[model samples]
Target: MKKKRSNAWLYFFGALGGVLYGYDTGVISGAILYMKEELGLNAFTEGLVVSSILIGAIFGSGLSGRLTDRFGRRKAIMSAAVLFCIGGLGTALAPSTEYMVAFRIVLGLAVGCSTTIVPLYLSELAPKESRGALSSLNQLMITIGILLSYLINYAFSDAGAWRWMLGLALVPSIGLLIGIFFMPESPRWLLSKGKEEQARAVLSRMRGEKRVEEEAEEIKEAERQEQGGLKELLEPWVRPALIAGLGLAFLQQFIGTNTIIYYAPKTFTNVGFENSAAILGTVGIGTINVLMTLVAIRFIDRIGRKPLLLFGNAGMVISLIVLSLTNIFFGDTIEAAWTTVICLGVFIVVFAVSWGPIVWVMLPELFPLRVRGIGTGVSTLMLHTGNLIVTLSFPILLEKIGISSLFLCYAAIGIAAFLFVFFKVTETKGKSLEEIEQDLKDKHRGSLKTETRTAEQ
Candidate 1:
């Protein structure tokens, strides 16, 4: 009973990084609207400002695996919290575009590292039976962050307070820094680092004394096998998990999720809604995003990963197609405006329930204990890379191709995402992390033998 109460607090603080990730990313959607006037922005500079953090994130996530592996997850997350503080305060106070870009990159580093560490930390700490629901807390907080940003965007829309929107990230970041101090480091990480006594203590605190021994022994055995590095990531046995993690990461962003996240206000304005109306529309979409993510957190364990993903991909594809038709045929009418909002709502709804949570949840589950940190980091790198590409190009693409055509392209990508999930992704709904890793090893061995037999024949 005591452990249960403590864990709820632990998950809340540990996943607070997602709120910062969501807010920093989502605030830009509204902030950029007001920013264009004061900054003397063009498309190129706009993309640069929006994507600089992504650039920083690329490096942050690339290095975080080693950082978390070497220094420990709790410390890595604490460092991210500090970086978030610096970035938030700096970006809000910047006098010019160059300074703002530099600060945003700093924030991006925090975002990158947190995204990798938070889910990894949560998954390791959670029991297998509730891992999906517990891990989904990260996504749930992210949607809440995005929703909060949208509300703030609306509140300050008339005043044009973009700086405040960008700066408010400091509040939760500070909260995370304080809250994390009271939380335990991941037991698996402790065990892997040869801190078995500490690991057992953490597990005892988290899982109760009776369950700690079995779980500790399991982690110890897995840790004894190999220490994962870049080379291990490329080895045959780890490749499938690697592919699945990377694929989901790529498709999650490439399907145009972050474009809406980072540019919904701009997109709505382009569709002929007034500026206030545009930001308000995004608030509605943000609301749906939060609500549906709750639905996902409710059923991710029961419904399984692949089904939710396939359903979401199909829904997103249809929503984008409908959105495209509305933009092309209606062309800025009142009818077109409402239709666009509804389509986006549907898109957000399905996305929050499926791709949004599942990608983060699955990345940690896909790899073995040895490679989990690096695997998650590499996958997050791909996620941010896709995000950077889409976000940096969105305004330019919107200008050249227009919203109707852009959404159609997204719809096409959604199709590819659906097919990829159907073909390449596996179900990890109820299996223990060790069980899944063992399954991968078994499949690899079976494939090697089949190849040998075929070659001899």
Candidate 2:
């Protein structure tokens, strides 16, 4: 019980990174309107403004794992907090859209690093009994950040105060910096670095008197068998796991969650809400997201990852179809208004509960220890690359194809995602890192052995 209580504080600090990520991403949905008006951006330029961060994120996510592996997760996350402060302040004070885009890219880099590093750090630190709940806190904090941004945006909407919305990220970034200062480094990371004594000291505090040596030994064995490098991830034995990680990363974005998230206010405006109402409604969306994410955190372990993913994907598909049909039936004006609002609320709920948390949980665990860092980096790069494509193209797609068609496309992608999860993905609910690694190795050997026997015959 004491150990659980002590670990709770560690998880809390880890979650601060999630808050910055959520705030930075969510703030833009509301800020874009004021930015467009103030900076006089058209659809093309507006897309660039919104997507610049995603572009930067590709680099941040792709590189963060390597940096974390080398410098330790604590230092990587601290670096990310510093980036968030710089990016938030720069974006808030930008004199033009061009400068704003530049600042946003900086913020995006921070978001990318936080998104990758925080989950990895949390998963390593958490006890198996509480890992899901604790790890899910990352997503929970993200929702809180989202909700907070919406509330802030709504409060300042009348004043056209997008600068304040963008600037508010600094508060949490500072909190993250301070909170992480008091937190210990990941024990697993310490063990990887050959500092077994230091690792044991940290784990002892979190694991109590009974299990520290056992846990340390387990960490050491996992590290011993790990083949850490980018090239190793492509070896035949590791290929399947890499593919699974990459597939989840790709499908998470291909399903188009961000299309609605980053552009919710704009979509709401299309449906007929004025700027203030749209911003307020965006807050409502964020609130629902927070509430449902709490629901997910409570049940993710009990209900299991695969079931939640299946349900969420099915829900998203239906919601997107309904959303598209509503736009079709109501025409561009009335239907677009209500349809977007209702559909987005449903979609956010679905995403928050499932893919949002599960993808992060699954990616790091799927790869072997040797290549975990590089594999995660590659997978995260795929995620952000997909993000960049979706974000950069959504506005153009909406304009060219219309909202209904755009939604229809997303619905199709969601269906594909549902099928992929139902068939291809395995459940990793209760397995330890070493157990998961052995399971993969056994499966790999079994496949190879069968192939050899068949060839001999």
Candidate 3:
């Protein structure tokens, strides 16, 4: 009972980080209209402004692993909170577009770190029995953040109050910082740093005195087996796991989820809605995303990861195809606008319930302890790289190929993603980290022998 209480607090703090992430991402969509007018941003510059954070995210995600390893997840998250404050205030008060872009990159650093470290921290701290549900709190908090942002933005949308929209993130940043101050550090991280006594103390506080010693021993053994660097991740047997980690990461972004998310308002306008309705419609999309994420949190463990992935991908393909056909057939009529909105809402629902949470859950779980940090870093890098590609191209693609073609392209990628998940990915629901690692290694070795036998034949 005491352990459960302690874990509840840990998850509460971890979810705080997710709220900040959601706030940051969600704020921009609403703020962009006002920011563009105030900053006199042209279409090209608007795209740049919107995507600058993603560029910053690439570096942030790549570096966060090393920072977390050196500083510990607790401190790293605290540092990100500080960055969020700076970024949020800076962006809100920017004197010019250049300053806004620079501040956004700063915000991106925090966003990137939170995105990678929060889930990892939760996973490490959570008891194995509750890890899936607790780790998923990150997504739930994220959706809540989005929903909160949408509501905040809606309330403030009347007077072009984008500054407040951007600045509102400061509330959660402050909240997260304060909340984290009272939270315990991950025992796994403490053990990794040879702070075995400290690890036990934390575990005892969270898991009771009876279980602390055993749990500490398991964590210490796991840490002892870990290599903890980039070169260690390059071993031959690690390759398959790496590919799975990075491939899933890449697929999560490459399926064009962000095109809908970051550009929902503009995409809606392109279909035929007026600006007012488009902005209002985005709130609906945000709501669906939040609700479906709730569904995912509820069912991820119950139904398992693969079913959700397959279902989401299949659903997205159909939705995207319909979205494209709607655009092609109706050509910016109100009918097309409503169809696009409905289909896009479905797309958001499908994605939020599957890839949004599962990718984060699986990435850290799939790799063995030895190279988990490096493997996660590499995979996160791929995730951001894919994010950057879509972020940079989506606007340009919208201009060049038109909306129908863009959706068609995304639908095609969704099909590819479904195929990959079906054949390549393993079912990992309900497995412990060590067990999953062994399963991966066994499969890796078996595949290699088959390859050699075929070559010899």
Candidate 4:
């Protein structure tokens, strides 16, 4: 019950899911350099290979809620780990571009599953007192995983060992598979399934003896007050939450964040950095990303969500504007290269502290117990679908519209996202799930009143 075994270690293992996603993202940025030559890929084919994982992720997220609800979080995660191992190995050994694309899809499925499951799993398992910080381990490790991938990219650049770049993901995937074997199923999940005694035992260790029964009772009461499924999501009282959730998940991908994480190497090359310098620069960027995410995790509970989202978007808008101007004025000159790097660093720092972790934390928290699974799946599907669109389109955009034009577009999206948060999003800081739902209901009633007045007039 005391959990002398250390929940931190368990969380670390659980977050290996994030590590694989990061690794998959980072490896491709640099590997594409060699893969272009080996696979005879033009821009379109290369984009397909890189975006294949995102395509796979769409499927994974779409199905995650059903899988996790029916089979349990532990099993869903274990299934993902298996996919990671197979995908990592298959990708590294693929003899042709077509085979490589297939393998990346496999890896994408693993990433999608993790994105849907890991944060929710950690949130359900952690004590309320430390929920934000602990649940943030998913984002934290993802930054670490990206950093490791960049390091690998740099280390292998001279040797041209792109195969090793991808194959190494297998090591951690296997570790995740074994580590999951030890974790008890989520206590909240057990309670949802009516396995109260098993749920209490998990809670005794996750929280403590004094809190287990109380927390269990709270979950049961909340469940009693709610009705669930796809239909429930369309209710007037619930529509705002769904809109807010989907917006956060979707924009979080397109606010120009993944461009840096997924295409930093390519962007640098376009700006005149050599292959090795570009890869190393990516490592520096990845390091900044991880550090900022850590700082955000430390202060998120104290600072709350809405303020951070607003503040971070302000920084992103400014950075994207400066980068767009630089690219327009200097083109591929040396100064433009340096300016792009600095602006990207600023963008990643702000984004790391806010949207990256906050969105993931808010997703599971925003929904009621009855509809959490369906709601989570729907939003996650949108999140990855947005990711796929951005990833698939970036190369084509860069080629057709030019990088300056692309930066301007992202900057515009950033402004729109800021306005949405200001006008529409509610702050859920320090509120339990039930409390958040009540707040949303109050707003929903106001919305109905406004609609009624309009109709009567």
Top candidate by lDDT: 1
- Candidate 1 weakest lDDT stretch, 10 residues: 220-229
Candidate 1 vs candidate 3: the lDDT winner is: 1
1-457, model 4: which lDDT tens digit per residue?
3355677788888788999889998789999988888999998998898889999998998888788878889999999999999999999999999999999999988988999899888877776656777788899989999999999999999988899998998888998999999988987778888899999888887777998778888888877777777788888788888999899999998887887888999999998989999999999999998999999999988888899999999999999999999989888788999999999999999999999888888888787776776678778889988888888889999999999999899999999999998987888777766677778778878888999999999
User: Model 1, residue 312: displacement in angstroms?
Assistant: 0.4
In model 1, residue pairs whose N, Cα or C atoms come closer than 3 Å (at least 3 residues apart or on different chains), thus clashing, are none
Pick out the ten consecutive residues of candidate 3 with the lowest summed lDDT.
Answer: 219-228
Candidate 4 TM-score versus the reference: 0.96
Candidate 4, residue 115: CA error in Å?
0.4
lDDT for each residue of candidate 1 in 247-285, tens digit (9 for 90 to 100): 999999999999998888888888778899999988998
For each candidate in turn, give its C-alpha RMSD to the true structure in angstroms. 1.0, 1.4, 2.0, 1.9
Per-candidate TM equals 0.98, 0.97, 0.95, 0.96
**Candidate of highest TM-score:** 1
Off by over 4 Å in 4: 1-5, 445-457
The per-candidate count of clashes, in order, stands at: 0, 4, 1, 0
lDDT of each: 0.92, 0.86, 0.83, 0.88
Q: Put down candidate 3 lDDT per residue, 1-457, tens digits, no spaces.
A: 7657767877888878889888887777777867787899877788888888877777888888888877888998999899999999999899999998999899889878888788888888777666777788898888888878877777787788988989989999999988888877778778888788888888877777998877777766666765667776777667767878888999998998877767887887777666667778889988898888888888888888889999999999999999898888878577887888889998998999999888888887877775665567678878888887887788788999999998899899999999999987888888877677767667768998999999999
Over 1-457, each residue of candidate 2 has an lDDT whose tens digit, in order, gives 8767777788899888988888888888888888887999999988899889988888999899889889899998999999999999999999998899999999989988988888888888887766777788888898899889889988888888999999989999999988888889988888888898888888889878798988888878878876778777887878878888888999898898887778888888777789898888888888898888888888887888889999999999999999888888887676567767888889988998999888888787787766666677788889989988998999999889988899898889988888888887887888877777788889889999999999999
Worst 10 residues of 2 by lDDT: 331-340
**Residue 215 error, candidate 4, Å:** 0.8
Off by over 4 Å in 1: none
Tell me how far the alpha carbon of residue 229 in candidate 4 is from the true structure, in angstroms, after superposition.
Answer: 1.6
